[model samples]
Target: MSRPQGVGDGGQGHKAKHTVLALAVAALNFGIAQGFFAPLENHPSLLQARLGLEAAQAQLRATQSPVSLQAQGGVSFFEVTPPPGPPTCPNPLNPQCITLPSDGRQITLGLTFTPFPFGDVSDAVNQAAIGVEQAALGLRQARTQLEAQAVEAFLRVRLAERGLEVARLGVRLAQASLEAAKLRESRGAASPSEVRQAEASLRQAALQQADAERNLTLAKQGLADLVGPSSDPPPRLIVPSEGTPPQVRQAELQLANAQVAYDRAVRGVLPVVQGSYTRNTSDNDSLTLSLNSRTLQPSLSYTNQSQGRSAPQDRIVGTLQIGLSANIAFGVLDALEAAQKQVEAARQAVEAARRSSKQQEDLLRSALQTAEQGLANAQQARSDAERSLAEARERERLGLASPLATLQAELALAQAQLNLEQAELGRTQRILDLYRFYALPLSEVNR
Candidate 1:
């Protein structure tokens, strides 16, 4: 006899539809994951870091072009009258001692500039460039930190999910034990106390399952918070690849930045030289040129003047002046000594940072090795527990062991599984932490 044609056709059709559905679901999931991680630069933390880098770059540019220019111009209306007493004029024929004109205007214009010199300005530019480098490093560090946090949160969710599964299994085992105990009591083979104990165990398991469910929900929410809102579920936890530690590099960067700061502080007390020019126009038009340094200043000025009571009687005079001056502030030597001390202090700090980084790297390496050993041990224990449980079940099937003994074996197996899962989670977490210390991107580390 052959199977009905309709029944065989229906089975094949159902399988084909199921396969198509699974493929569509898998494609959708792949697209979602690609979309989530594609725009890494646009992540909120990275965007903020990029802004900080841009600001530092702007400051560096400003320091590179440090020059000051100033211009002033104004118009003034003025009228002058002689005092009540006799006029005190240098020229007796000037205006014939008459009243001054009521309508007169004077225009004034001036321009001054100070160019950036080599001493302080150069130091500032160098410091700003260092700042830009620090900002870039800070951005990289922030990215590393954020990725580590995301992975940690994801792992926590995975751990919670595992815990919930174990809790559910525990409840099932407890209920089965309770049922077996009640059956034995009805058959007069088990005491009432045993039934009561079994009931208590089942209740405890139910409570544990509830707690596990609550924890799982909280974990899922935390994972959602880290990855932002999305319809897709959390991605599977991927173990990161081992890489070289970043502590040494981080220490080097700190030392370089400290050196830059120390150099800037030392330059702060050094001599400064500035060159300046000024042009002024008033009753007298003057042009001034000057060169100034820490100790000496030399200047020259040329002036052209026009003075009279009327336009035709105006007299024009031109004058030239030159001068030199010297200045010595005793405080600059004191400042130099203080800056030297600061440089020494910064040098010491660099050494301290280097030593600390070395210590941290060594400690993490040791911890990673320990965690791997622990995971291996847990896996072996789980294998033994599974084997024992299988033997206990076979013995019960042959009526050579009590139901309670088989249930105990199942409970042991469940505990072993839970321990193994926890050990695995711990190992994964430690590996990720090591990857983070190495400054490896979680996405690339997974690859």
Candidate 2:
């Protein structure tokens, strides 16, 4: 009562494995373009960086403008009466009752400008410009980080999809094997224990299929969270040739800002020159110029009556004023020394960052090489498994192999194919890591 040696699925399961393999190979030939990452531009961190850049730009604009203008207007009501109860008019019937207007309106316009800024004002501008640069770099760094995340998510989805298909194929092969084992048991040539073993294998395959499905679902959800609800994953890895790592660029900018601070501390002790213009409705129109230093301030001003308001010639005058002031602090020298130290520290940080980046690049290159080797080995194993399965089928046809032997061969082939797919996915991941480390663009579709 022996079951036939060649008993399962005719070659359907084998063909399905081949189909998955072909799909995986096609994926390897297709490279994901940068357009795929465009959807991630709206990621929260990226949006934050963009906002920071805009703020920095506004600050820079404010710093570049040294002049300010202001306008103020108001209405006032007042009454005036002669002191002591006295009638100024001589006529008894018409006493000289002097009365003043009860209400008046006035407007004032003022303008102030720094003709030449000193004592850290110019330094303020330079610092603001540096801040703008830093913000721009930060935005670029955020984009690169988003690209890295997108690539990782993409890899997970691709691997999970392949795993789910492979698991399904495994289930099918297991079911076929179990059916052959049952036939043998019904023929009284196989024990109940053997049938139970086949059942156990089927259950294991089902469990694996369920796990694969869960993983794929989770991978898809994570990807959607990153890019959007609709994500079209790229077929394969995209690696750019070269780029400066964003961290190193950011550190260099920091060093520049530090250097600027040091320069400001050394050169910010010069005198300042300022000018102002003021217009008033009731009093005078004035133009003033001044020079100020830490120890002294000298100013010259000219005032004249308004065109529509009459005034004595004496009201128009020129005035010169000189004021002396001093402020001595214990930490002035210490502050300069501290700024110098910061510059040196920032320079050192830049060097350290460069060294660390280079080390990371070397490590990634080594890892990529290892991944390539692993992929080659997996492909070789799959080839061997295919040969073994073919041999097993030929033996069964010649009546030289048992049903159990053929089933094992088929299982080996399925596992080898799965391993090959996984290896391919791993190699793509290594390439992505290398590209991401360099802050290189992953896609050139739009470039």
The number of the candidate with the highest lDDT is 2
User: Which lDDT tens digits does candidate 2 get at residues 255-344?
Assistant: 988988888666544334333333232344655655555312333344443333434543545445555444346777888899999999
Worst 10 residues of 1 by lDDT: 105-114
The TM-scores, one per candidate, come to 0.68, 0.72
Model 1 has how many clashing residue pairs?
0
- State how far residue 398 of model 2 sits from its true place (Å): 4.5
Steric clash pairs (candidate 1): none
The Cα local distance difference test for each model comes to 0.67, 0.72
Off by over 4 Å in 1: 1-50, 65-117, 229-327, 389-414, 435-440, 444-447
- Regions of candidate 2 where Cα sits further than 4 Å from its true position: 1-35, 72-108, 111-121, 228-242, 267-283, 289-327, 396-410, 444-447
How accurate locally is residue 314 in candidate 1, as Cα lDDT from 0 to 100?
29
